[model samples]
Target chain A: MSDNTGTKVKGQSCRLPRKRFYRARAHSNPLSDSHFPIPICPAEFDYSHHYPYFFPSGGEDHKNGSASPRKVRFADIGCGFGGLLVSLSRLFPDTLMLGMELRDKVTEYVKERILALRASNPGQYENISVVRTNSMKYLPNYFGKAQLSKMFFLFPDPHFKEKNHRRRVISLQLLDEYAYALELGGIIYTMTDVEELGDWMRSCLEDHPLFEAVSEEELEADPVVKLLTSATEEGQKVARNGGQTFRAIFRRIKFEEE
Target chain B: MEETAEFVSNAGEDSASVAAVTMDVDNGLIEDDKSKDAEVAPALIAVHPFEKSVAVAVGFELRLFDLEGNCSVSLVDDSGGPSHSDAIRAIKFGANGRLFASAGDDKLVKIWATNPWHCIRTVSAEKRVSAVAISHNGHYVAFADKFGLVWLIGLEGDNAKQSNNDKKAVMILGHYCSIITRLEFSPDDRFIASADRDFKIRVTVFPKQSLKGAHEIQSFCLGHTDFVSCLAFAYPSGCANGYLLSGSGDSTVRLWDFISGVLLATCEVGAKVGSLEPNGTEDAQSPISDLCASSDGSIIAVALQYSNRVALLSCDFSNGNLSVAKVVTLEENYFPTSLGSSSLSKCLWMVMGASNLPMPGSAQLPTRLRIISGLRKDPSDYHCHDPIILEDNEVPGGQKLLSELQGSLDVTKEEAALAAAAAAVKASMRNMMIKKEYTLERREMRKKNRNDRKIK
Candidate 1:
């Protein structure tokens, strides 16, 4: 990995970041509000700042009214090291994805990693970015109602205590907010190596009225399902140790009147 | 090979049960430890529309005093269910005075018939209840849980039949993962406003078919810099639309046009109450605990957390402005935990108490009730006479009402204890409402000592 450091190609010099320098603790207290500035609402969120390629500066397209505004459709909550975002960027090159990380250094590392990838490959990796934020507290401030098509909770912190269950990323109550932000037929993907945490996430999804479990046939057909355990840093670490993983993928649905 | 060995050791250590000695060192290490066990529920007060009855919920106990009947009405519950097994967090009366709702940490939302004071229906919640509100038409009772989900139950069916079968509550809306502190239905019942600990007030359109869900959000009133603790709707005498009033831990009371989500006016209530210290530490800003608007929507009563006075503000709907009009100071060092006022009366009722106060030697915690009259609807009558703190004899129901609701009339001896209780209540409120900041090392240590990760 060090061999690629400061590599120059076609008048551009970019290098991949080493994992050892970007290590961060696994857990962050979502209740703490002392983090990055959050937009007051989804409308106030500057898409141009996050995705300059899609939303060009100077409001040229906005003035001409020729193109509809592009919005982020995919979110990876607690995207540690942003390994999944990096992997998913090529698979869906046109889709815009955001990784929300609470740790300052980890978010900075992801930002640098994305910038390096964009510089090295040009035109690619433009659809993915990372922001330092407490997603649990500021999800609505970034995403509007029915704005997202997919969400990923990959190997999130297992707040094990009964009192700390509310801190869990995937919860019955939080699913309501996720459901609000997700478009109809949107999918939420969650995976964990801990069996207890996996069961908890699955049960919460099962008990929620707005969510239904994605069938095995559908899961087997979806490409994102395979990436759940292969793309993220935590997933790779767990795989290296030969650890078993459990996944729960559910779709946001509105119940038909009975 | 060294990194692999470290990974294996970490996996092995996490799977093994942590020893008691190691666990003891991590316990109570977080800054939240001081207020962890001091979860004394603040006293909540609700008044009937006609000023004929007043209800107070301190701990698990609910006390109701009837002004017309001149007696304390006993609650009759034939459901044989346990009544309010935990601290009561919210109590509210319906618009018509026929229904009263009380919910708390017990996870039970009880609806009562006001005349008989009977538990008409008790709906079980999925989590601890935080806020409760009854629709203006008295058809639905909405309660928000600490987990941020709001549930609604229909009250149109037979009371007995509904009580016999555990009626299922329909999920209406939610405020993400934040604790919802207050819920208020717009005067027309067309909208339901919910305030959370995350400094957001969402005004959702109450659908005609609410069982489907409150999906159409009207607007989000989003200027509060801290947790919004209270919400009230004010309808100007001749205005067609009602204005939304909110109080927050940021020490400000704001008025909003809920229909359009426009912030009309903000009053720096902390400065008005004279509670902000010169140094201006974060703790110096006293959070507004409770607020209520008069029937005519001209006067507003705001209760600050650590202040011994209630600041009254006058709302001028003509220009959509709010300004502090009067600061009524209590005779004793009484910090009100809740405030209530009747629509038909010009009196403001305040309660100073908590669920389980940390008094040195007291076995029973006593509540102190005070009443102030002369809150006029006419702005011209503002300076006619200062609002009078009614003597015990002049208060409605007199000393009898005080003893019935407050538990004891002898408050002189427990003055110091009440002051201490106020401080304790303030500390717990700050712990629950204010987000705590931690250093990088502390965050790492907390993650390292997580019981879930350590004990598998």
Candidate 2:
């Protein structure tokens, strides 16, 4: 870790390294920063690959205008490689989906996959998109407060050491961000194979202000249990290992008092 | 403050360095004596407490952490193989901590004894055990499972072989159309409270020295509109009249009169209360995520939905005042899932998100247990120079702020947006014209300097 002074270089505070840009039209990457400081290109909108048809419009309150038929119902946070999102989008055809990933390469890969899937099934193509941003900071920007019905926390990095616990995704601070993004009575779906992680999630959700565990009995009975058991990319791996999977669902609770 | 913290971290290169520093401040002999005493007391107290403790009970793995000098020591790892064909759902200590029991999804309840964590017996329940509790005297164990059946098992005697042979569960089926979520034994060991999905709390009185019949239903506490998710009887320590805290699907944690089935107070966490399903129907919103009452009954900590913020409230039950004393808000990614409190100190530990496994699947995140020891109450320190009162309107006031924002802010409202954009462009163009005209007028007066420039 750099010192705070080092963090404050020039006028920027820990400015991220500039992203490399490649030109598809020119079929070349910029070779000189001095001469080709800024690339000039017309912004193109192509939904053929990802959404060849019109977006869905059948959400309950879409009475005003017909924007698109594709309605986003599910989203995966930190979607790496786009494998899970693509699989889930196909599984839940009626529910529009999204994958928000921080890594540019992964996000690009997911977007490409969504596009390819859209090309094949143009009619059902509006169900997905990948956003590039740190999930923790961009949650409020990406989804309205309580806009998401279901949020997925796949295999998040576990900052295990005692001092590094704060860096872990499941902390008292991060749950608030999740709560804001999740719809009231909506669910935040999470699965982790690490016993400690599973326990951490259970403890966090069970103790979080926004959610309550859909008791072990209720969890078994819910229809979503099928998706939890078999659909998720992570769920299948746990099963193959003959590893015992600990699953718990936390439903957003409503405030009872005025 | 950051610099000072960094200095401190750098100063202590290792634990030995810390010890050396401590000895420099205090006499080496006195420090050694304190350290020696601290290490030995836990062993002395271990004999008197629960013989075998189950710390982490999930799936097939049951990890027990013993309470040492202000910390818990994991004992399950030390004594291996408390085997079950499936995961373990619930675990409890009985026989004054001598007898330990665990049950799981595979519908088998396995019993064990301590000294060395070892499986002693197995009690088979027809259904899966979802929750478990032990009597104060450690003679009787109570459990509720998937079939909504509550069972009372009596520990025959201290003789290991005889106890293993006579292990029997007296099953009492009563909950209708819903699975049981939580089952807990009252401090006195006379009453057991079981919460289920039907929103009804079943309290049972155990008959002494008997597993022959069934647990007599003492009372049925009912009020919550949704499923009863969690139930906690206040730890018996700093208060009288044990307070029973229950978290429900209604998003509210209600305090019961412990024995009388009377609703003392209800703490509504986040908005969504009174609604269970969000199909735009009347029954879709509920607020409470989960709730934990402090051991002394002075504080009830509730995890609120929407923001996943944990609200620590001071309970002035006599005055019917449940004031928001303090709030610890977490981010959106991590869900504050489960909460457990230490039997010794009022230390609170919570499991955060599930473990993160590598590759093709989602590995459940490790349960992060946090020990929230009571904040030192210094009345003198309460008065600060600056008190920032957060505006209620900034964040959702117990409501789903995201939904409210989404409902109001429609990005696709092009007609209204187009008009706003046109107006903004007009304003910007007018400002630009003014600046351009002003600059053009000034440039003409200074133009002669370039034309009349000297050759040099």
Candidate 3:
């Protein structure tokens, strides 16, 4: 678990963090009010702090319209250990991506991981960042309506009890909020090793009126679909254990007017 | 707090079984050994648009009293469907008094015709219903579930025929994972406002075709420190747009310019009503349970969970300011659970009763109905005299109204029991609305023991 991807930066060694030291529990309750400061709305979010390289003049000057502000179009929900974000950052170099994790220590680890990578490979990994937030309650706070182009729900916590069904991240009710945040034709990518949770997620997506399953031909042509099982820590663990994974990719669609 | 600390400490030694047992107790999954028959349901009340009738839902029974006829109105359902099998959480009347909607734990939304008191449509929802509202135009009915989704159903012209087939409800919007507590249509019917347990009030534009989905969010009213419990709109004379009023579990009532999403004023009803205990424990904090605005939009009556007094606030629409005007104290040991006010009436109706009595062997609890008359729109005239608590005989339907709505209960003999019921309701409300905090190890254990994992 020690990362050897270190490089010399300003005569100092910027070393990657060890995964063992940043180990956290597998799940965190999304309903609890975690101790973290959340932006009231998307306008109030300080993008300069998360992506300082993108906003060279800082966040306040970007509102002056000297340059059109760039928004984060991709979100990785429950992005465990920031593996998927790191992979996606390289794949989509021009696109901005954000990883939302509930665990504080994991978020800190991802921050260090990104910083270390940026130091090792200069001018790269600048478009990806991580934040500690309960996305279930605050998705609308950070992303405006139709602001996102893609959403990833990789290896989500499967709240299995009948009473805890409402807590699942990929529920019909929650899809409405996701649908509101995502632009038309925006894709929602979900993957899980647990078969029941995978079925549940697929069924909820199928049942929602605003979402339509991505065609097999489109999924095969998409580069991100291939990395669903190999880009994240959870997916890597499942791969190592020789466990099969299930995926449900859906596109946000507009309803026909009656 | 101490219990959470103890559980965290114990989790280090033996995590799995201990955490599971603790969660079961915390969630009330383990049945109580003491009183199996004790049920604690909150009594809800709704008033008709023209002050023609008042409907009260307690447990599984729906009771209505016709003010003009001075008689009980029996519901006519040719389908012969059973009444509400569980506690009804919300009851509301349409703007023109043509339709009445009621839904609750049973997940059935029943739309009734007001004139004939017949159940025209019964729609079964996927989850327990929390709040419901009929559009001002009386063409649409919307209900919100505990899972934070709002569903809409369009009504056809005057169909009193009973149909047992479940009508499809269109899903319009949602509040993420939070429970939606209140749904209200703006006075002009241009927007619909939904309040959730996450302290958010979203105002979405009512689209021309709502069945397609409400996509445009006009604004978000977000200042509450706790869950929002109720919402109302007050439109002053000569004003085209109405101001929005919201009450929250944070013990405050706030007035907002919803069109622009600006918080105008906040009145600390908790401080005005005073705490039940002087020590100021968490239990002493009074959360507003229900609130209603007067016909002229001048007076707002607020009811706190554990307090025996209803605090009235005066609204100044010119400057958008709210201030506590008066406090009407009720009889000892009685706390108001719900409050109702009609557009055509000058009286504020209040009900004090619990649906399920927590006391053993007390299966039948008596509900008490009270009314306060002489509520005026002019601030000067409203302040000139104290609010008059009308006697039972002075009520619109008099003794007949009391008997029809209250079910001929003897309130004097159940004073002690009523006090206990109030305490139980307060505790249950806290448990239901407050978010529970858990340690990392306990969360892991709970996930490990998930049934989905076991099934695999």
Worst 10 residues of 3 chain B by lDDT: B13-22
Q: For residues B224-303, what per-residue lDDT tens digits would candidate 1 score against the true structure?
A: 98999999998888888888999999999999988877789999998777663223343447899899897567779998
Model 3 clashing residue pairs (backbone): B39-B356, B41-B356
Model 3: per-residue Cα lDDT over B1-456, one tens digit each: 333344344422222222221232232222341232323567888899789999988777899988878789998865344568888889999988999999998998888988978987888898888899999888889999876789998885432222436557888888765678999998778899999878789988888777667855667787787889999988888877788999999999998988877788988889877756323353436899999986457778999887778888988877877888898887765687899988865888988777677665545556788998877645567456678889887888888888777767456666766676677666666666666555677566755544445544
lDDT of 2 at B412: 33
- Residue-wise lDDT of candidate 1 within A167-252, one digit each (tens)? 78887657767877888899999999999999999998887767889999999999988888888888989999999999999999
State residue B50's C-alpha deviation in candidate 2, in Å.
9.6
Please report, in order, the local distance difference test score of every candidate based on alpha carbons. Answer: 0.80, 0.50, 0.79
lDDT at A27, model 2: 11
Highest-scoring model, lDDT: 1
Tell me the deviation in Å of residue A244 in model 2: 56
